[model samples]
Target: MSSSTSTSTSTSTDDETSSPARRRSPLRALFGRGSLDIQSTLLVMLLAVSFLAAIVIGSVGYVNGRDSLRAAAFDQVTSIRESRARDVERTLAGVQQAVVLDSRNDSALQASLDFNAGFAALDEQSIDPARQQAVTAYYEDTFVPRLDEATGSSTDPSLLEPTSPAQAYLQSLYTVPFDDDFDASLAFDAADDGSAWSQARSDHHDYFREMVDQLGYEDVLLLDLDGDVVYSAFSGVDLGTNVEDGPYSRTPLADVWATALESNTVDSSFTTDFEPYAPSLGVPTAWIASPVGSGADVSGVLAVQVPTETIDSVMTGDEGWADQGLGRTGEAYLAGPDETMRSTSRELIEHPDTFAADVVDHGTPTDVAQRQVATGSSVLLQPVATTAVEAALQGRTATTVNTDYLGHEVLAAYAPIDVEGLNWVVVAKVDTAEAFAPVDVFTRNLLLSTAAIIVVVSLLSLLLAQVFVRPVRRLQHAVNRVSGGEIGVEVPVKGHDEFSELGGAFNDMSRSLKVKQDLIDEQRRENDRLLRTLMPEAMAKRYKEGEETIAEDHTDVAVVYADVAGFDDFSRGMRSGERLALLDGLWRSFDEAAERLGVEKVRSSQQGYLASCGLTVPRIDNARRVVDFTLELEGILERFNATNSSRVALRAGIDTGQVTSGLVGRTSMVYDMWGDAVTLAHRVQDVSSQAGIYATERVVQKIGDGVPAVDSGTVTTQSGEQRVFRLERPAA
Candidate 1:
């Protein structure tokens, strides 16, 4: 470990004899023995010791910090997803209410029922001539044109006579133009004949058309009690066709019709899960079918087409997702009971072709991402296979880590939606790569920072060794003269480092062997002040009066850890100067509690404070004192909030066990303690949720006999059970 020169000195020190004064302040003790041998060896030892210790501390810190940051990230992501799912459910519920109100107020339904009753009263077969003409006109103009645009069909749909229900649906494939009012479109050439049949067809078509435009439906249909499409606003080709015998017999709409027929009350309605509606060029769609009735007699069903874009807007905010905090790859979407996505993806919405193309190029054809992209429907109708969706579809709420539809690892939250008549699930997720990106950056930056610190320390160690050793060479010359009985000679001490101080000490020793007897009284008083700094009063007195080493073995010592939370988010938001100012002020307040309680304050770091009681000064109430100190921290934090307008709180952990206590690190004089007890105290801090003072069973066993400790119960993990308690600060 030592450099070439340091190795040679070590060999020389092994050969030469060491003297007594050179043994006192170890560095001066080593050099005063006629050798650079020990000084060079000590230089290497100090560098190696500090550098290795720093590497160890840095590694442990980086690992713990990385884990904590990852935990915070997951919590943030879960919250974002839950909020989005609630929003989606709330928006859909409102829309469902709108449909129910509109269906109840649809005037065309009453008029159609009135006309049907009148026509049935006619013994001979009767049909509305004006209604027939309007149907033909609607086919020739709107239906034929929009169909041609949607499917690129040049054939005029009106030219084909409407002999079948399929043909009838094709003729009414387009909605009414926004310019035409429903009242005007439905107003037939009615005379004083008092027959409503004249505009029965016009009334049905015009009212449904107006509803689609006003309520933003893609299409609307009126199906009778027998599952027959009696009228259609956009895709009216299915009129007069029973769903079981119609061209769209196999679709989800037909299945929902059985439920729709039964929902005859004004408030009752049926909402179907998505399926390809053959009537609408075989595109994916969902419909809310409200009952069209006269009291208890169900006349028909008013099926309003839910535009996929409405749900898309709910998932992908109309403005953008800046407020959602889902990052680049996060998205919210709905999944039907059939497990297919029922809303458009943000990826597909942004770059429609890219997702499909990427999935194809990657060759994972069976993947959900590929399937959704390939569906080509306005609302995605692709099946997904994942734990979150599966659990959500089963009506369970879940937040988990899983491989997403795209085969990318994601942190996902899914919840079953309980809309009036739809079975759907909301899934909100983000690619783990984007979500935990800071962890990677943090690790790299930590390594770079540690490397820089090591390099600087290495360089400073070498530089200081040379600087300190320069004066020691002069002291070596002066020590030789003093040893040879040349008492007048002095070692010029010119610096503040170890060697200069050693040289000064030697100069003092050689000049004052005659005066050393006179200065003994002064040194004893200085020792008294130092003892007070190092330990409690009783121990300090023993140490000063002549205890060689101050140490104790305690059967029960209560170790406590108190930390301020949200510091990462806090420090990141503030300027460097401001951050240090805040921490300095906060710690100053934190230290006061330990100072007043006679609890030995050990050390403080970014992880926060460490303290212990009943070691230096023996006491039976170590746990009691530790809990009291923690409660003081709560008050300090409470005051900190009142003054700073901040909600930042302290989180603490307490444990009772045996530990060795002593003054360690000889040169610097550090009074420190350690054991399994210390580690558990820190571990408890991690397990706690907030600024809650938690104590372990060991602390409880000792404190419970006297103090009122509320058992907080145990945190059972796969690893083991950790029993803890919360101090309900025993009724004063």
Candidate 2:
């Protein structure tokens, strides 16, 4: 009892001394008492991975949403721009057709003639000179003041005054009476001035005025072939003035008059770009002119002023911008080659103060904004020299984000309008802040959602770490056992979580491994069997051992080459399926016969069968065995002929000599023989004209009297002449 107590005390003292060393060890320091355990480590790693994934997903989603919203915004603006362009082109084309058709009609021609004749008669009739002076006073006092106010230009009224007495007399009646209401003057058709021109006006004036109202024209005028404005629908200051040499000769109307006169065809019409005109209170005007008569009978030119409000209506959706899918801060407008707007500005109509401040901020003079506001229009007033406008005027259609005329970043779509004579570009734009508002909201919500996901995942991962680690630890133990060479080790499966499925899979895998090991051994035996069938056993062994090249020279070997002599003609009458089936059966019989006769089949083709003796396995009577195999093939073919109505006979050759044999291909390897013996056997088999077994002298001498034969033929060789014999079965 004293000895046992002494031993226990010594062991206790030793353990106490080793405990400090154990605490200071590398492994202990790595996972010390204060360090994180496996569960904590797993929780931390899962949370880190989840946070990273959430960030990546949120970033990617934001980028994609921003891109999609940008693309959608561009598409909307581009669609609106293109639609507005088409509307502008369609409106201009309609105006051109109306002018061309009206100018060629009978009423226009008669009115042109009557107005011209009546004007000449008025000059001869001695009209009142005082009334003519009143026409000049009306232009100087009333017309020029309004023209200067509207156009912001100082113009002498004499420049727009009538140059003839007949012009003064006509304007004194039609125009001077309605100086207070000039627009109503076009409708004043019930005049009884007793002049033929006045009577012509009463007849055709209402028709022309209705055309102006129905077709949305500012005015319509008839000019004689001499460029004399003989009749006017509005009877403005341009009445009876020669467009060729009048004071307003520098205008686009004069240019159109010259073009119409120069072309002189009824179907030919001319158009002019928008320009400030002295008439109609100096409103921006474009003109369409067509010849008055058909072909060579052109008597006069007809001019129609293009309406600005009609184009603005189509482009702005009749000022209902929001209804056209353009939300607040969006507008569609046209810009001329001069960089001035052709359509009205939406901002000027909706928010004039904002328009003024924006334009001035973007480098437009303050006076220009004031002028636009005064006229209550943007045409020929607002300048758009943006990148989109420049590109469009250069005939490029594109959608992009750029600084707009007001210097605001905008999503703009621009394209050139396809009008015949106008160098105009259509632009549809929306402020970037407004267009990307949804994207901003999406980004904010995405960030909030990502934070929520991180919080939820953090809590869930802490719980899941415990759940996941238990199975992992169990699996690790089982895997260690397997690594230690204990296969078929299984872990206990618990709940139906992924861990449970994984444990079940591990157990199934352990069981499948044992079964697969046996299957592998069986498959190896099968592969070896197939390999031995393809080549000699020795060569197959070397091939499976990964031999790169395998060839052997055998000194005394017998090779037999046999074929169906009439197989071509015999198979010609059979279908492909029947022929193949017969060939497969015949080869099988030959193979079985070869095995019985101690011969090995090298390879067989549809044309022939080849075999060897004493190549793979040595035999003292290899020649006798090969000759017997050849006779057996003859019997096989004879049986086939009897059963299948085939007339095929066996032709074979046998040679006994040194030959080289080896596996011959890379992927689909084949065993074959090549040497003088193989060559001579092929030559002898082909030379026999009859169906018989031919043999070389070597084979004949080897077989001796085992097979009966006769001298057949001679085959030429490099050594000298080799004799061939026709061998027959020994009295079989």
Candidate 3:
């Protein structure tokens, strides 16, 4: 019985110990004692967050990088295009300037003047009966004999026959003494005095020679006022034949002459590929012409005929960019204004029809070629030869683009060549894929680098989450306490790392946020004060929201332009501050008067002030506004004259005009007016002499018959000449 009792006690003790151990094991598992479930879950969340962060960062970086690179590339292209354009413009400017300078030279002008004077004097003197008879005899006998000796013919031959240099030289000499029939044949005895004839010949020859020498060009044909070639350095061509006889003779010289007469500036090219002479010559030439004159008068046109080869060399020369692995590779072709290829490589030159056949077949070309011809630069990626051709015709540079040219995608650059009188476009093209090869390589490398980093970051996120979960939980609790208004809650710094800094920062941020909120409230009050000072509450709020106030046009507006005489000199001598003060004082007084008159002051500058009436309020008496303003300005000046020794008087000119007043410039806004009426008002002010007020005829009419105006004659401006009248107060 004792043995049975002992066995039952042992069994109950074992059961009690085993039950507690089983329950403790399950509790430990739930709280992450042995299993890595808690760590694993935290790690998975961290990796997912890291992966999202990496993708976001990588995408943002790629987009930013791509945009930056694209901007840089576009900038590079713009710089290159602008540089080339400027160079071309500058070259044209230089040629124009040179021609003007040549025309203005004392020697050239004096020579031309002397020649005309000499002819006039000769006409008067050579009209005497005795001299006339002598000239008539000289022309029939001595002149004809000399002409036959020089030209090897008695009568003038048809211009159809090819001319010889000797004949041309003789013709030039013969025209000297043949001013009249009497002068041509008249001859004194060899033994008698020959001074007049010899002197006349020498003077004539010298004038012609000097004039020819001044036009120092070989490929150019120099025409006289009559459109006849006076001289040609090339092939020794003479000008006795009509202009229609020459290759480009039928082309209108009148157009060039008219352009030269109207504008002192002349830099233009003409095309003539369809002309009879062009095809006969085998290569079309460009004709570039510039007016030879100063601002005074158009002397003559200086034209040059440049061959295609000359232009080709200039367009394709090797430079710094060419050596830097950025060389442009393509076939260059010259096309006429008619869209016909003028010149190309020998192979393409023989087959001009196939110049841009692939692009033309696709029918996707815009009016890019036409725009290029007109504006001088039009970038296009189209499959059309006509497009490029049209651009050349408009005197513009163009680019031809296509996904494939004969099965190869191409990017072409076209430049207009204005040679002589011809319009030719130079096209350079290369494979598009090859051109962007570098960019592709860079993009691939970037993507690969980003992928590698993402993988590495994902693995590192797992380890980091495992190491910092306990510390992070403690920090989170501290942050919550601080956020709940528990000040001075200490967050334990477990490591000298970002987590420790983050804990301290969070504590500081809580304090800072409260201070910042208070400061923000104070700033809002300050801003309200400023807003009240600048504008009404409603208007200020609307302005803050970036809403623009609509402005109505004032029909009965009185436009005023006030200018100071000798202000230009004052500005030059005085310091900027003193000048500013003077201007400010004048403007302040003007502004006060404008406010009283219910007018809106538009703009003010160092030169003058411009203002308008009936902008804020409807004007009942627009004429009265002008009169009152003028009188008020005079009174102010009179007061100034008494007080200040150095008196500054303002000249106020007034006129009535329709005005659309509105604010301009976002940062520094100003009210301004646009249209012809406003311009006319300003011009009226400009025409005023000293302190006088000049008004246009329209303004004077509006003032009624009561206000007398003195006729001020007419003033001419870019708009047109206008009859101006001087405005003054009626004698009282």
Candidate 4:
């Protein structure tokens, strides 16, 4: 309709002024006859019409396209932002439920009672001075370096050691001996240490570790009524120390512990925002605590370290930005009330150098970015000083275009996360450069086309208005479609005139637009492929298909925890190259044995090896198979010892029970397993001082005479006493 009206208007004006006298009369009336020739009059009339049409059409097209792109960008981010906000709230709610439930459970009550008794018992007796010094040395020599690595701070080792004698004694048993293997500290509940506190920990520690593993918590702590950290699942430097006033007296844990103490009801829970936790080596840590009692008179506090990875996974969409409909530069993150990030930054993972440079450009200190990169986290590190963060923190919800933390202009959707006891905001943003790229291309092409139309109309008007008007109208209509986001719209070419050339250029532009769109689609596909490269094809597919949390519970599985005895001493006398080679060869042999015996290797570090059967693939004889796998490991290490002329021996533990396995991280996905089976295996392995294969009663029953075994002493655990057996080589 617009095209017909425009063409008719042009035709009527041309017809009325076709005669030179008529045209010259208007020109003379407008400006004197000698001021403009007939040809000049025609040229001016044509230029006015073409310029008006171009300006009106170009203005409408640009505004429409810009608004469309803006709306789409806002919608994309808003959807993701809302989803992330919901997930965050749901996650926190789950944590709250876990805290409240665990706090009221019999296990927590028993643990508090047992631990308090054990703590009081220790306080009554004097600890060995040498053992207390060893605990102090462990913090100074071992814990401080690990803390320094995570927080990028030179903390005083002297200030970190516990002051209380009982705290020192507990640390000596749990953390001091496992200085080389920090993660092992939590698992070695049955440390073969003759201490009543050790027995208390062995009895109840598995419950906490299993909870942490199942729920993906960083740690779980039990504080007595007097504010002593009587039990810690990870057995960090915090255990046995009083949170009311201790070495970590001023930390977030203390603050939360105080909050829990004030809560009048058992169901009452408190959550603290992420802060640098001293015990976790200054790693960004948040806590959720509830009173552990049946009524208003609280017995103690039960706190769980909030797993930041779970938050990061939800916020970052497992680092699958494109999968979350966020283009390459788009990301979702949490901003605490402090205006610092509470989740991982997408740029910090994809391009750390770029993240550092951009953040530095945006008024962040160079050292801050360096620390963020060093720690491989943005939580409580990256400052988000954007308008969106400000508004969201103030409880406002909206989507707008503004400068991001990195100073990039972004379309951001911001809202406060509606989690109780948390003052956090969720912001999903994408750079405008990426979001409005199509609109930008449209704008540039529209301007150039309008300019070309005006120039071509000037010359063509003098020839014949009617002769070229139709072609110009055709080009204008095609431009209208292209401006409305109709890529690949082509104008039909007639003769090889200048108008035809214009038509050809339009076709080329349309084709270019199509190609760019295809490239963007291809890039998204490439991103999916990249995710596949990081994990198994099945898991990647499941993740791509939008399963937010991938986890499985296997009813029957065998887990093995193996560590090479005398490795530290053996490697101490060798060069770095030889040391690494020996470790590599040992691990390689373990892996090869696992593969041959159909046992899946979960993970292996220099400190220990973990493998499982009936986890990935179910097997009825999983326990027997894992026992065989450990026996094979013994043979491999024997051969390895002969080859290297070393005296290293294998100390392994095996158990069969239910286990849960899942992917744990976002940027670096890890397939890991946890449950009673894994816990018992680790505990049993650490219970014996001898270098041999140990199996729990469950494994012993499953293998039934298949592998020769002798009775290993029973270890008291959370589940009464568990009989352990030592596997012996066949009498060949």
Q: Global lDDT of each model?
A: 0.65, 0.83, 0.50, 0.82
Write one digit per residue (lDDT tens) for candidate 4, span 157-180: 887787777888888887678774
**In model 2, where do residues sit more than 4 Å from their true spots?**
1-35, 469-732
Give one digit per residue, the lDDT tens place, for model 3 in 482-592. Answer: 445454566666567887887677657656755764666566667655553323344345545555663446677777777766555545677989878876786678777
Against the hidden reference, what TM-scores do the models get?
Answer: 0.52, 0.61, 0.38, 0.55
The lDDT of model 1 is 0.65
lDDT of 2 by residue, 302-344 (tens): 9998868878889899888898889998999999999999988
Which one wins on TM-score? 2
Total clashing pairs in model 2: 0
Which lDDT tens digits does candidate 1 get at residues 1-732? 000010000011221234444433444454455544655766787678877888888879888878887776777666766776777678667666766665666474674464445333431333355544555676567555655554445855544334353333223222232212333322322323443333455445456566666777776666666565655554334545567765567766687677766655767767776665544544667777777665676676777777677777778777376566877888878888766688876766667667776444444354545446545443544556578889997889867889776667888888887786778888888888887788888888888988888888878877777765667667777766655445556777665878677777777787785365235445545655555544556765554444557677777788987888766566687898898888878877777788798687766656577789877677788788888888888888889778877777778889888887665543345555677677777777656465578888878777666656666767553447878777665555
